[model samples]
Target: MAEKGKLHIVMFPWLAFGHMIPYLELAKLIAQKGHKISLVSTPRNIDRLPKLPPNLTPSIDFVKLPLPHVGNLPENAEATIDVPFDKVKYLKIAYDGLKEPITHFLKTSSPDWVFYDFVPFWLGSIAAELNISRAFFSIFTAPILSFFGPVPVLKGTQEDRTKLEDFTVRPKWVPFETTVVFRLFEIKRVFNSFTGDDDDVPDTYRAGAGIEDCEVLVVRGCSEFEPEWLKLLEEIHGKPVIPVGQLPTTVFDGGDDDTDDAWRGMKEWLDKQVKGSVVYVAFGSEAKPSQAELTEIALGLELSGLPFFWVLRKQRGSADTELIDLPEGFEERTKDRGWVCTSWAPQLKILSHDSVGGFLTHSGWSSVVEAIQFERALILLTFLADQGLNARVLEEKKMAYSIPRNETDGSFTRNTVAESLSLVMVGEEGKVYREKVKEMRELFVGRDRQDGYVDNLLGYLRSHRRLKLEDQSNGGQRN
Candidate 1:
């Protein structure tokens, strides 16, 4: 007979790198425990997935689903990285179209558990129809989930939908008073996206609907970082809220970028810098800064008088443009101490190096977790989405300093950026933040600590079996 508790898990993540990476990590952990893992994605996304270890190759298999063709979506554009932000919605529409193909796969795979991302409101119904289990995997931190609260309040028709300021004050579901909400402009940017142009239904609706339907929340966070908030979510959701740790990351050596001229150039310069004195800067894959913001950040780095390495992704739509306009002669002036790369660099290798001391980042969750794993102090300049909230959590822990922006205009100046970066890398405050993050690194990177949370989640999933007969009686439909 087959092993009783040995389960088959299907992981379906959204088309964003931030979402897919964590889900892949979780799948790896579960597969390490001898459970089977089937990772489902569109063609290109599966091809681009992080290289699985040789051992895992035996336990996991990729199940490709063809993205449905949609008007205005570029051919082969199946993920957020494949299109610009404005075109991302078209990708979402195409993602929703995958329901049929995914359903077909589920019916055939018939896995014991299906772990899906924040989108895909229809998957719960599919799971119910198949009489298989469903779990929602949140790639966001506990604070982001807590800030949104439970499904009822966020999905309620009674709430106002126009002005972001209405919901930006604080989440309605938090029983205790707290100052955990987005700043005005951050709210404005998200609100602009929340109410889409055509508005058949926003992805937020899918998120909330999926939340209301899921059996549990398998989060990429740990109690050490967010105990109070995690507890609050369990109470509010009336279902299990499992913290899966930050999910340990393995650093890549001699990665795709290692041989590129920009990578070699940065490495040669970085090798000469004093240990723990250089700061590495790179926004995540999707955060494309505007020309004005880029100019300000460039000026700020120049004036900081510290050795730094900045990765400037090629300008959008114009792949060949090497560098955006920096202050005239700035590169020549700081050539010895400041090195800028116009291509992707090995961020994991750079951060893990002894010479790197701080990270100037856009505060994406995956980047934050990786920086913490390497004990690097953070200088957060949040750009979009949940980044503002993630920055606040680090600031609350005294582990990072966020750049100050104008309260009304939400614009930050070159001086403020310089000051924040300096304070985090060289000032007395930098020392305190560095020490605090170092302490956190031990807890964050410990294999035993991470495995403990995984063991708990695995045990729960093993014990919580539902009656297939009862589900069949209910027409085997997802609610």
Candidate 2:
């Protein structure tokens, strides 16, 4: 603990912005509670962080490390939102190479604990070896985390991977009926490649990623939103699983004056539409759909005939294509019925707007929570890891509908896209899903009224700090 009654802590996050931002928010909250946080990242990302809160900035320390040489990633390419996929690979290499420095910092600085995102599998073990307690922080909601526990390992040839009927059928152990079972096989294939025999990375670097045992597992469980998976994680890990509810305060508070302007603009636009008449569409920061798919989605939105708002990134292409070109006059055609915001928007604010009837989303946990918190109906279109599982949960809960993508190739055709969007926007089934979402949203808001997530998280942190201090005192006396 610091002399001024602050607990000294360190935070290490994976290279991705989505993963890093939430963890940084948590750190900021802890700092508000009189804790000093040392955040570690590649030099590029550290340089890119929006300006920090004045008070928190001076209290928190930033540690920047070099990226390992991989390929043609430019030196200035650290914090740019448009980092290429190959560059992301290089950043991972850089993150991997910093194991020694990280371990050294853990050993020397000896903070109360360290927090890590997905990176080295051996992170927990390394922290243990350094005699430091560590926490595994996952940005995923509980249900998504629950699915990753022990499951029957499928042993089959590559050809067997394609049978949708075989894949959709549930494994005997998994307790849900899903049309999405085939999707799990796809994830398994990716996992296998990362852990396969031909891979140069050690098994320790691949399998389990050292998360087998952790002192504590921290989850973004804002709103008591994911109960089933939360219970499952407790059962699987046999450790304290802490759901630090949403830490709402940001390091960059969007400046003092302009913050209200974005909120006011969205609210004004939303007020003009009927209740549940507009669709909000946004792929998260890291997800970039192909130009063809982007066009297909746009056409689908045009077909749906609902008022909508789509948030698009300025540049498209990460690990996929170099440029994403939209159809001519696409923006103009939709201008009366829709608005497209460049770069980021006030996502939470938009979701909370009355005119914002439903969300056409990528099923990111953060976005999912926001939708639930505001009680907006959802149309799920997932593109990456665990998002499929999240989409399944929302669909199962009757709070959302998913676009049926081709199982073999993971493509969303126009018909499937149009129908799914309608299901959330105007269909009878869409109404039912919307009502269910309303119910869940009501439940979440009621819970928030009684016990807001931010306050709960702060209380947990204080309790955790006290528990650690007691444990240390007991150990000292015994020694």
In lDDT terms, which candidate is top? 1
Backbone atom clashes (below 3 Å) for every candidate: 1, 4
Backbone collision tally, model 2 = 4
Question: For each candidate, what TM-score against the reference?
Answer: 0.93, 0.80
RMSD for all candidates, in order, please.
2.9, 4.9
Give the per-residue lDDT of model 1 (tens digit) for 1-479.
05676888889999888788888888888888988899999989998776887888888888998899998787777777667667777778888899998998899888888999877878987887787788988988778888876675456553544577765676656776666678887776666555555833565667777777788889888888788889888887888899999986663333554356766666778889999999899998777777677888888888788888888764533322333566788789889899887765778878888899999999998898889888999998887888888877888788888889875556888898889888988898678888888889867778999889889999878766535434657776432
lDDT of each: 0.80, 0.67
Residues 14-88 of candidate 2: C-alpha lDDT, one tens digit per residue: 777677777787787677767788998877688766668787787789988775655555555553255753345
Badly placed stretches (over 4 Å) of model 2 are 2-6, 50-59, 72-75, 79-81, 150-207, 222-225, 246-276, 314-321, 342-344, 442-479
Decoy 1 TM-score against native: 0.93
